[model samples]
Target: MRRPTSGCSTGSRRPWNGLGLLLVLLLAGCGGDGGRQTPPPEVGVPPSLREDAGPPVQVVRLDERQAAELSVRTARVRAALAPYTLSLPGEVLPAPDHYAVVSAPISGRVARIYAHEGEAVRPGQVLLELESLEFANLAADYLQARADATYLEERVARLRTLVEKQISPRSTLDKAEADLARARAGVGAAFARLKALGLSDATIEGWSSTDRERPLLPVTAPIGGVIDQHRVDLGRSVTAYDEMLTLIDPARVLVRGFVPPEEAAFVQVGDTVEVGPRSASAHPLTGRIATINPALDEANRAVVVNALMPTREGWPRPGQTVNLRIRTGTPRPVIAVPLAAVTYDGEQPVVFVRTAPATFEKRPITLERIGPEEAVVTAGLADGEEVAVSQVFSLKALSRFEQYAEE
Candidate 1:
């Protein structure tokens, strides 16, 4: 520390005097001039950096224990379900009125068959052609009968002339008359043969012009439907009662079920029913009681019940197995899940109940047959429960999440 010196009235010339006076003041002063303020504490060096406080704040992080304590899923308890109806197992079958078997009408080689198996055919469309020698014989008969009739008329005219002259006997005239009657009868028989041969009048006219012979019957369809089977091939011979093919109109399909004798009593005609697969936007067909087979199966004591389906449009198909929810009893209200939650596992159904934000439990559920989408919860789960309906497969792997975490 340096001592402060006041300038003397008469400035001292000698360096010795100034030095002497400064040394005398330092000796006399208690607090020196330079020692009053310490250097302003080192700039930007924190008091924390100093011993007074600790070091500065650095990185931040979350508490993992708090997150683990939070629940991921939610649910509510439900009551026992009593509102669902009975479901019947059934298969689609062709309706009787819409089914027909097409057969050939004659025994002859099939000249041509244009229709194929499973092909649609319209009524009166030519299915095939069967040709025989009957055409020639019938045409020859018609010609002979017409020629003989012309000859008999000439004879009868001459006979009448002779009778007027009294030269010919009355019995001769009677013979001529009888001959004319026989000729007319022959023409009638010939005409009948032409019709039986299935020759149209126009076809006969063309045949007469070309002097052609060979009976061709165009075996046409009796009803329009898709051919299920074709027995007659091109150039193959077929006879009456020889089935050409079987036809079925798929639009008139039906779902058939066999109701047990006990349940049969409750199922009357015109009862409304629900059907399944439970998929979204899957249109259901309206159905009415078609008929009940009177005889009961001796072994199972089940009676066959056929339900006629409504007009179809790209929905159900024939021979498809379907679950039929027949309303065998009264209706009641119940809690239900979205169509998506329920998944079929063989005969049993299942759903996933969210237990936490990221965890779900595999719960076996029993559903009552109600509607296609809104199925009744007969067993597991409850109302207001959040089920893994969408993105379920993502939850599918969650069942093994703990094992994955360990790995």
Candidate 2:
């Protein structure tokens, strides 16, 4: 063995050189040969076997490395911030400018109907034809009284001519004048009677020449809109107390939001609000608030707010229910992060903010509700900080469900 010392020395030096190279690689972890990644120790690898073995077995802190990788992804969350809140219940109703109920002015049987349900009507348009014996009788009396006045005037003129020629007494001419005045007075009384019965001046004048048109409807719609409800059909008589038809204009719609009494306290007459159709998936239709009810509903403990929607085509119709969100104040710039940025760690909400390219620190925060898409941070955050806004559950699962077993 002493004679072969150089050869033995060379063999021993070769293994030590490889071991030294491996130690450097394991420490730096990159730009190294893939000869062997030391097999991590199996569970229950006894401490007594370590020195006798050729190479020591190793252990990896897998959970610590996994948590770090997950934290890196959570640092990208960004969004608009809002205050914490609860969504209050609400309903859709007709706009005040567009809704109207047509009713009869007087009791009468409807003879003909011009406007049907879903029909559009204008102001002063005739809606129906009515027939009433009371109206017809009044017309007949006026006609007869007019005929009497015409006959009396002729006789009065002849008698006055005779008296003027000394063929009749002065008392006789005065008596003829009195008789004519009485007939004229009767005509005036009858004309006044028809005027009080809702006979338009045009219709009244038309009645004398044409006997065909009679007992017309009151035509009482003062505003224009579409008919929603029909109370009477042809040949059905209705009264003034009965609602004949309901009309609504689409352009003048108002949105009603039933908000909690506490939330409503911050609402003002000019606050902004958003209205969307029942099927609106994400985006909301916008509008300004027109009114806020000061009193709360005793039954629901909520205050009613009316938001005025402008005339926008393809918007929801009147009485069409929708989702409403009332913005209580102006939007101010604040640190806004996605809902996914903050994650629950069993009982506490925590977020991982990026401290370096590969390093992150976990921070806990209190959440505030904005609208549907974003959340505002009430505490534990600053504006424009890089926080994880993605893959929250993955972070929690890796930290909890994927914990490494102790060797």
Candidate 3:
């Protein structure tokens, strides 16, 4: 048997049985199992290494697939020359020294009204006539005082002559002189009273000795202006406190502008202003700033600015409303964007700036001024950067979503 012929197999070896071959394969598979054993725990790393990475960054990185689902759009920001001016609503007012109210100076019956409503009058022109029993009594007292004054003067002269001629005693002459002086003082007091009743010195001095006429007290205009109103009619009884007339000189018209406090700093006493009537067809009136009130209006919270405007044939009346355009300075270059591009993030003003393709970042900006359709950016943005114009809120939403996911 030679021990199965040492290195060679005999034909009767049965070609290595199938069970034995299968056992060999199984052994080979088991030999490599130790090599596949899980990497011995990454040497020096902690088990919670990934957990210690902290929260995800605030950046939103969207691939093309993410942006395709939204209707977001953007615009390139560029430098612009924005106007530096303010438009405000204003009203026409009577100038400070040109408005007047006429009131009854004394209790009287209206005898005649010479100045009618809407009539123009000059200073010292007769406005109306009043007849009063108080005035008649005053006139009578004045005339009587004058007569007594003259008679006492004659009596004083006669007494002096009598004393000088030794016909009357010195005591009697002194009494006569005292009575004459008293009479003269009374006459002076009566004249002063007449003057207080609005009588001119010329009228008082021109009175005739035989004139016993009941006086008609004339009310005269205090200034040259149009008669805006007349309250009294013929025979209408009025008291001293009644307002009988109103006068306003259109030549002294002022445009009173109520500007918001934000723009008040630009207004001064010499700024130019253009004012237009409420009607679109009327021409605009131009003027210069006459005053800028230091205090704000308590009712509207606005700074009051006044412009001295020409009368312009009195087309713009007092208390008439108007529109004002105040030119502050010349236009200059600035960085601005469309007003629609800006939105608020809480109380902070926010804008979305495009950083890369289909990528945006929410940015806070400082606005210098806001025009009708544009906003001037003072900081936090530069020219040539693209900004989201439409559907910017969508970008904000994505940022919010990423925030919630991290939480």
TM-score of each: 0.47, 0.53, 0.62
Ranking by lDDT: 3, 2, 1
RMSD of 3: 13.6
Query: What is the per-residue lDDT of model 2 for residues 1-407, given as tens digits with 9 covering 90 to 100?
Result: 35878898998899899999999878776544455578888797666576665422222223456755654454444334344333445667788777887776567788888888888888767777677777677778888877788888887888878888989888877887887898889878888877765567787666563567655655555578777888888888777556778887766677888887545555677766777765644767777778887888677678888887765683667657777766664255445566667677567667767665544455677764444555666677776678756655554454444334432
Q: Rate the local accuracy (lDDT) of all candidates.
A: 0.66, 0.67, 0.81
Better TM-score candidate (1, 2): 2
Task: State the local distance difference test value for candidate 1.
Answer: 0.66
- Judged by whole-model lDDT over C-alpha atoms, candidate 2 comes out at 0.67
In model 2, pairs of residues that clash are 74-388, 75-387, 75-388, 84-369, 98-249
Which lDDT tens digits does candidate 3 get at residues 48-75?
Answer: 4676674333455677777787657888
**Rank order by TM-score, top first?**
3, 2, 1
Candidate 2 lands at a TM-score of 0.53
lDDT of 1 by residue, 1-407 (tens): 85445455245556778888998898667456655676776667656567777323211111355225432333343443433345676777777777788776556678877888878989777777877555456677887887798899999999999999999999999999999999989977887777665556665444442455455667677688888888877888777668878888877767777676655755767776655543433555656666778889665568877787744563466667776767644234456775676675466676777655554666778865435445567677766676756654444444445435645
In candidate 1, which residue pairs clash? 72-356, 72-357, 73-356, 73-357
Best by TM-score: 3
